[model samples]
Target: MTASVILAPLVPVVVLWVLAGLAVAFVALALWRGLAGWWLRGLTACALLAALANPSLQEEERAPLSDIVLLVVDESSSQRLGDRAAQTAEAVAAIEAKVAGMENTELRVVRFGDGPEDAGSLAMTALAEALSEEPRARVAGAILISDGQVHDMGLVPALPAPLHLLMTGREADWDRRLVVKNAPAFAILGEEVTLTLRIEDQGAAPGAEEADLTITVDGGAPQTYRVPVGQDLDLPVVLPHGGMNVLQFATPAVEGELTERNNAAVVQMNGVRDRLRVLLVSGEPHAGERVWRNLLKSDASVDLVHFTILRPPEKQDGIPVTELSLIAFPTRELFVEKIEEFDLIIFDRYRMRGILPMSYLENVANYVSNGGTVLVAAGPEFGAVDSLWRSPLAEVLPVEPTARVIERAFVPELTDLGRRHPVTEGLEALAPEGGWGRWFRQVEVSPRAGQVVMQGADGRPLLVLDRVGEGRVAVLASDHAWLWGRGFEGGGPQLELLRRLAHWMLKEPELEEEALTATARGQALTITRRTVAEGPPGDVTVTGPDGAEVVLPMPEAGPGKFETVWQAPVVGLYRLEQGDLVRVVAVGPSAPREFEATIATGEVMAEAVAATNGGVLRVEEGAPDIRLVREGRPAAGRGWIGITPRGAYVTEDVSVAPVLPAWAWLLLAAALAVAAWLLEGRRGGRRVSGTA
Candidate 1:
């Protein structure tokens, strides 16, 4: 119980002050005048003012509140290095023992590891939250057990008491990290892009002024380079293809460095092509010839070279070749000299007419075997004696044309493989039921180890696609496909079909029929499997950031897409593989923030700790002795950390009563006034008697 005097004034405090001032002035005036009843008047005024002031005795029933200390443990990736983990355990044990033994003290333990987004060493954030949940008056102190590499120092809370840091790493610890200072998110293919990188030494790196770094692209073979440390290195890289390119740069691990995780950095750059060069060879000027020309020329990124064989060399005309407005085709330059310059070559109803020599055709075949792409759009002439099937290019063709042409209106349909193929998977959706236009002709053909993506004229292979050596070949056996371009029977997806077909042949990563792709968003992996099959594919094999592998079954997402979202238990690189496909995805930071500053120091928390009049001591130097200190005093010594005693209390109940009642004060004042009057009269009468 605590007792204190409190005022309960009948009027405002200002009124009381006014009355008291008046009484003081009257007393002073009476004293100056030497009045006989001055003492009696002063006593009556004091009594009246006391009754108006209403002073009371306030007694409070109090219970002592226990002081709370927050103990935070850091388990970020950096904490896993060297003896830091063990050192942290020891510190935690000692703190718990000391706090537990203290009288009327409670330990509120809060452990924060790597955050979901890989935000490193969130000691301050966790401390702020813990402080908010408890009463500020009761929070005696906070003790953080970490490496002191805090990423969110801005969250350092307004501590009501001292905030001490028990740092985890030794002063001699050191680390070396590779930093990609600048890199473009998108790089054009066939153009060299410059990437700025730096090799940095944190704490105590070895005395080597230069370091050797191994750089690899797309998990390919590594190339080593000796580079100067402590400075930026500009690396020029040219993309091999148009797709997501993974570039991994790593430095050799030192004997006593903190960790190699930061020694390596992964950067993903998307590769895009500047232009697509296409060569279109038309046998004759036909209605469908404009379709091929329009498709390739319409794209701003494509460079189109087109030629039409107006007349064969054996044919004679009345006018001279120059006067007849006929230009000789440049077969030698296109086929023999700069054949590899074009990304793709298209042949539209080109029958072997002795125009291109057998040697040129052989060169074309050789080109396909050496990473070239070819597309054959055949008409009825493909089944004739002079068909390209008899040329040297026949060896690279996916199908051999039979000497039969089916002439009947038939709707183009996707084969079982086509329905699952990336090119035609959802083509049917664009054309409603019976919405697709019909083709009037198709050249029958027999496939030789080629995928039939489309069929026409009684289920014969209308479209065949295959890989020849290191290159690709695609064939469309029907020439009436352009009939749909004319809106024949309410036009089909004529442009869409040809566009996807060309892109797929060009080996676009997105158009790969069978592929595995994984995308990461905040440590979660969205794995997608794209294949040309009806039912579900097999379970996808996932290689985690660690080399451990696990198989996950894929679920059907769309017509030919299979996907699953997986939350990774940790942050790192994940490799996903299914069949012949593989993909690498990075979760969170490529170099986790914890490992960024591995050589632990108390520098990060020093300011905050000092702000609360606390200490920043390393655990390696031995746990500091805990002591109690007064508020506003320095709570840290060379070998000791202090906690302030809050002396907080909770009021169980309160009672108040007036020290002196109004009636009592009034009665005492009346008696004093009567006595004063009699005393003054007696003194004056005595004087009168004496004078008489």
Candidate 2:
């Protein structure tokens, strides 16, 4: 219970003040005039003023509230390293016991893990939010239990009491992190691009001069190199394939390192072609000749070189070679000399005309065998005596001509393998309601090797893809594909089909017949396996960042595609493998921000602790004793941490009453005035008698 004086004036406060001042002036004037009853007059004035100024007593009933202590525990990924988890558990248990024993105090524990999207340990943010939820006046202090590698220090709240840190980890804690300073999102294929990287050693490191670094591209065999540590490494790399390429660089973990999570890094770069050089050789003027030209010319990245054989060596026309408008075909230059410079060579209805020597044709076949690409668009001439299939180029062709041409119109369709193959996987879905447009002509051919993806009249091979040595070869059995481009019977996906075929032959990673790919949305991994083989593509083996393997069955999602989503238990790089196909995908960040700096230190929370007159204590040295201290005093000592008592309470009941009633106050004022008048009158009578 508490009591205090409160005024309830009978008149307005201004009016009361004026009456008190007049009474005091009259008393002073009587004293100056040597009145016989000056003391009595002063007493009367005091009584009257006290009566008008009514005073009341106020009493309050309060309930004592316990002081609140905030305990913010960091359980981020970095905390999982070097026995920090055990240390944190021990410190929290000790602190809880101390706070329980302290008089009039309570502890509120807040445990937080890694932030979303690799934002790292948001210890300060968690502390600020917890502070906002409780009353500031009741707060005694805040204590943080972490490795001190806080990533959100800027969010530290304005604490009303002292802030202390019970840090985890040892003084000799060390870590090695791989930092990618510079990496391009897009890089030209076959050209060297420089990537800047650095391997930093933090904390009490052994000061090794160099380390062994292993680099892997597209999950292939790794190449190890000895490189110096603590310096920027400019690694020049040439992309091996077109499309997305995943590069992994890692340094083997050392014995005494805090963790190996930051020892590796992954970079994804889209491999692009500077220019697709294509050589188009046309046997004669044909309706589909311009189809290939138009398609290649439409792309801004393609460099097309087209030529037509207007007069063959067999034609006995009396036209002079110089007088003819046709330029001589550079057979030797295209097929032998600079053949490797071209990315793709297309022979549109080309026939053997004794123009290209047998050696030149052999050179073209050798070109295909040595990592080159060739596409053949066949017509009736493919079945003739001078068909290109009869020349040395036949060695690389995937089909054999049967000297037959089907003149009947037929609708092209995807075969079972074609439906599964990347080149023609979804072409069937693009067909119009009435089916694809019909083709009036198709050369009869039997596939000797390679996968037959498309079929036409009489179930004959319409499209075939094969690999010759290190190169790729594709055969399109009809020249009427242009009909689809011309919107014949509402046109099919002519541009799409040809584009897929061309890119597939050019060795695009995404269009590979047998491939495994993985994408990450947060920690959920979406694994997709693509294959042209019959039946279901088998399950995938996923290896997590911790080297734990889990075999997940990939159910068939579509024709030739198998996919499944797996929730990852943690954030880091993950490796996926199916048969010989292997892929690496980073779930959140290759090196999570938490592990980027693992050394436990007080620098991050130094300012907050100092401002609150608190100290940073290490769990390694044992948890400190808890004590109560006054505000604006040192709240931390050598072996103990103190909390400032807020002396906060809730008022449950209040009572207010006037010291005297208004009628009693009025009667008392009148009585004091009458006494003063009587004393003055008696004194005046005595003076008169003395004078007489």
lDDT values for all models = 0.87, 0.89
Error of 2 at 597 (Å): 1.3
Instruction: Write one digit per residue (lDDT tens) for candidate 1, span 1-692.
Output: 99999998999999999999999999788767666777887998898898898999999999999999899888887888999899999999999888888999999999988865666778888988888899999999999999888899988888999999888888888888999989999898889999999998888667679999999776667899999989999998898777898888889988898888888888888998778889999988888999998888888999999999888766776776667765679999999999999889999999898899999989999999998999999999899999989999999998987889999999999998988888888888999456898898899999986799999978999999999998899999988878878888888889999999889878888998888888888877899999776688889988876688888988889877999998887676677788777777767777887777788888777889889999888899887888889999999889888889998999999999999888998998898788767876777622332343
Model 2, position 472, has a per-residue lDDT of 96
| Strongest candidate by TM-score | 2
Model 1 lDDT at residue 692? 33
Write out the backbone clash pairs for model 2: none
- Expressed as tens digits, the lDDT of each residue in 40-106 for candidate 2 is 7777777667777878899999999999999999988888898989999999999999999888899
Q: In model 2, which range of ten residues has the least summed lDDT?
A: 683-692
